[model samples]
Target: MRYEPISNELFIQNRKNFMAQMKPNSVAAFNSNDIYPIGADSTIPFQQDRNIYYLSGVDQEDSILVLFPDAPKPEHREILFLKETNPHIAVWEGEKIDEEKALQIAGIKTVYWLKDFHKIFHELMSQSETIYINTNEHYRAAHDTETREDRFNKWLKENYPAHQVAKSNPILQRLRSVKHQLELDTMQTACNITEKAFRRILKETKPNIWEFELEAEIMHEFLKNRSRGFAYTPIIASGKNATVLHYIENKHQCKDGDLILFDVGAEYANYASDMSRTIPVNGKFTDRQKQIYNAVNRVKKEATKMLVPGTLWAEYHVEVGKLMTSELLDLKLLDKADVQNEDPKWPAYKKYFMHGTSHHIGLDTHDYGLLHEPIKANQVFTVEPGIYLPEEHIGVRLEDDVVIQENGEPFNLMRNIPIEIEEIEDLMNQ
Candidate 1:
């Protein structure tokens, strides 16, 4: 791993919290993600499963974590099964985690190779009455590929027909939603890395520069800071391209007087930071551009203040719609009649601001959290609100990752990143 080692206490406490919610005599298991294959002998880069990484801090493939909190043998309560490493294998690939290193990383005393998994699992399963199986239940998930966890779940259900099965997704969704101090610190590092990239772009950007060149600059900053790359595919949309929400074809040269919408972030230690900023190509926003940019910035500020505890995700967006509606009316995008006669199902504000105002942001860009439930403190979210005017070839979005505090306003993780029009203009010119 390029990132520094995380303290095992985080994993230890995470496991303790998860176990506290488990049914008695239940055995829960988590598997690492598969190294998916492309065509020919090549395979995609390995990404560790978030659940296993959360519980064990083991960021390797072919790893499994079995938590049997009520195991008959005390040492068997928390076990880690890792891929066997021999000297020859170590020469082929870099050294894999040995038993001692696994213990140090995961804070679990018991470790075994993958070869011993079936035999030990059978014994453990016989002693337990229920099994907690991990599943991908995040709201935004739409994958068709079967993951390693899915395959393991299938085999477990087929072989152990009598065992009572429970879903680990619900428990994990709630547990992982709130930020731990260490996790918040790690996310801050990612945001700081992203801030560096944004500042680098501010100085490097000029009229006639190709969008791909700007992308390269951001990648350079991220790699120098020990980040693998973007948490998600970056959207470097310029001019009318900014109105297209997911535009990623960064091929055109940024023309003078056009605004570029940058939806990008860096990842550190598998934690994610999401940010969106719209800046001018020629280092200065036009009069109309400044007007729209400041409108989005004001909406972002007010929306962030609404992220306090007890706010419902659904209701919060509704309130943000009202804020955006007010801005749209002021900008002449909507008149009084447009607001009065608008359908409640899809308000007049939807014409200018289409997407949701915010989403949970952490390990994943859209991190796991129950939107139906009331908001709570220590929950980190992205406050992103935008207005896209295709006719004027203008789109403006300002976003920041914030942590909902126990009292008063939420804390901004990207507070240091320049957002004010004057600050951005000064930096770009300087």
Candidate 2:
């Protein structure tokens, strides 16, 4: 990991909170993600499963975390099974965490080698009446590939058919939705890194520069700041390309007067920071562009204020759509008659601002928060509102990550990053 080590207290508290919610005499287990293969002798980088990392702070592959608050032996209550390391393996793949290091990192005293997992887990199963299996139940999850957690779940079901099975996903979704102070701090670091990249690219952006060049500049800043690059696949869309919401083929040379839309972020300590900013290729927005940008910025600001506790995610978007509808009417993109005759299912604003206003942002770019539930304090979200006009070749989206507050409005994590039209123009001109 390029980032600094997180305090073990965060993981300790997370485990305590999760265990408190588990059924009595139940054991929960989390597995580390596999190092997926790309081809022979090559593999994609290993990313620790967020659930295991959230609870145990174990960031390596071939690791498992087992939690049994009620156990026969006190030492077996919380256990970590890690791959055993030797000098030869160390020489080939760098040194892995040992027993002492694991204790320091995870605050767990009972650690075992992976080879002893089945033997010890079977013993625990014999004592426990229920097993809590972790599964990916994120709202956007649609993958077909089996993960390490999935395989572990399958094995546990086959071996312990009599044990009552319970899902850990619901508990995790609720728990992970709200941020710990440490998690908020780590996410701030990620946002700070993203801010550095945005500012650097602002100085480097000029007419005729390839869109990929700007993407490269952003990546350079992220790497220099100890971030592991973008939280998601970056969208460096320019002009007409920006109209395509998920545009990532940054192959176009930016033309003068065209607006480039950047939907990019940086990851620090595995926490994500999502941001979107649209700027002029020549460091100055035309009158039309300025109008569209300010409209989107206004919508973003108003939408952020609605992210306070007790706001439903779905209702908040509907309110934002109303705000955008008003903006579009003022901009002459949507007539009063157009909105009055619009379908309830697909609002008139759908023609321009199609996507949702916000989503939970954290470990994943689109993090885990239940949309049906009311928003809560410490929940981080991205407030993004855009107006895309393919006919005019203008697309403007302004986004910032924010933390919902219990008292007043949501706090913007990207507050330090320039978002106002005047500030952006001044920095780009300077």
Candidate 3:
């Protein structure tokens, strides 16, 4: 891992919290993500499953975490199964986590190799009455590949037809939504790296620069600052490309008067920070551009203030829609008649600002908070508001990560990143 080690207590606390929600006499299991294949001999980079990483802090392939808080034997309560390392494998893959290192990283005293998993898991399952299975229940999930966890779930259900099954997603959705101070610090580091990249682009952007060139500059800054590149694919959309919400081609040349909408962030220690900023290619916003920019900025500020504790996620978005509607009216993109005649379901603002104002941001860019629940303190969210005018070839979006406090407004994690028109212009022209 390029990032530094995270304290084992975070994983320990996470496991404890997760176990508390499990049914008595239940054994829960989590698997590391597969190192996917690209071709016959090539493979995509490995990423640890967030569920397993949250519980064990074991960021390796062929690993599993098993927890049975009320087990017949104390040693089986919390166990980690790691892929055993040999001398030849060590020489090839730089030392995979040895038994001792696994204990140190996960703080679990009991460790077994992958070879012993089937036998041990069978014994554990026989002693347990229920099994808690992890599933991808995030709102944006659309996986077609069968994961290691998915395969295990199928095998377990087929073999143990009498065992009661429970869902781990609900508990994890709530638990992972609230950020610990340590987790917040890690995410803040990611945001700081993203700020450096944005500042670098501010100075480097100019007329006729290729969009992919800006992407390279940002990646360079992220790597130099110890971040593992972008949290998501960098969106260096300039000109008409900005109108496309998920534009990531990044192969177009930036024209002199066009606006570049940069939607990118860096990841530190697997925590994500999401940001979006639109600026003119020449380092100055035209009069119309400044007007629209200020309008979008105002909506973001007001919407951020409403993200404090106790706000219901669904209701909060409805309020944000109203704010966006007013801003669009001020920008002259939506007329009064358009709003009155608009469908109650989509609303007039959906024409321009369609996506969303905010989403939970953390380990995943669109992380694991349940949208139906009330907001909580220590929860981190992103406040992103935009106005995409395809006809005018203008799209202005401003986003920042924030932490909700027990009292008063949420704390802006990306506050140091330039957003004000004057501040951005000064930094770009410097």
Report the lDDT tens digits of candidate 3 across residue range 267-355.
88889999999999999999988988998999999999999888998899999999988988887889999999999899999999889
The parts of candidate 1 lying over 4 Å away from their true place are none
Sorted on lDDT, best first, the list reads 1, 2, 3
- Please provide, for model 1 over 1-430, each residue's C-alpha lDDT reduced to its tens digit, 9 standing for 90 to 100: 9998889989999999999999999999999999999989999988889989999999999999999999999989999999999999988988999889988899999999999999999999999999999999998999999999999999999999999999999999998999899999999999999999999999999999999999999999999999999999999989999999989988889999999999999999999999999999999999999989989999999998999999999999999999999999999999999999999999999998999989998889999899999999999999999999999999888889999999999999999999998988999999
The number of clashing residue pairs in each candidate reads: 0, 0, 0
Model 2, residue 395: distance off in Å is 1.0
**C-alpha displacement of 426 in model 2, angstroms?**
1.0
Global fold similarity of model 3 (TM-score): 0.99
**Model number with the top lDDT:** 1
TM-score of 2: 0.99
Off by over 4 Å in 3: none
Angstrom error of the Cα, residue 209, model 1: value is: 0.9
| Local distance difference test scores for all models | 0.94, 0.93, 0.92
Per-residue alpha-carbon lDDT of model 2 for 312-362, expressed as tens digits?
888888899999999999999999999999999999999999999899988
List the candidates' TM-scores in order. Answer: 0.99, 0.99, 0.99
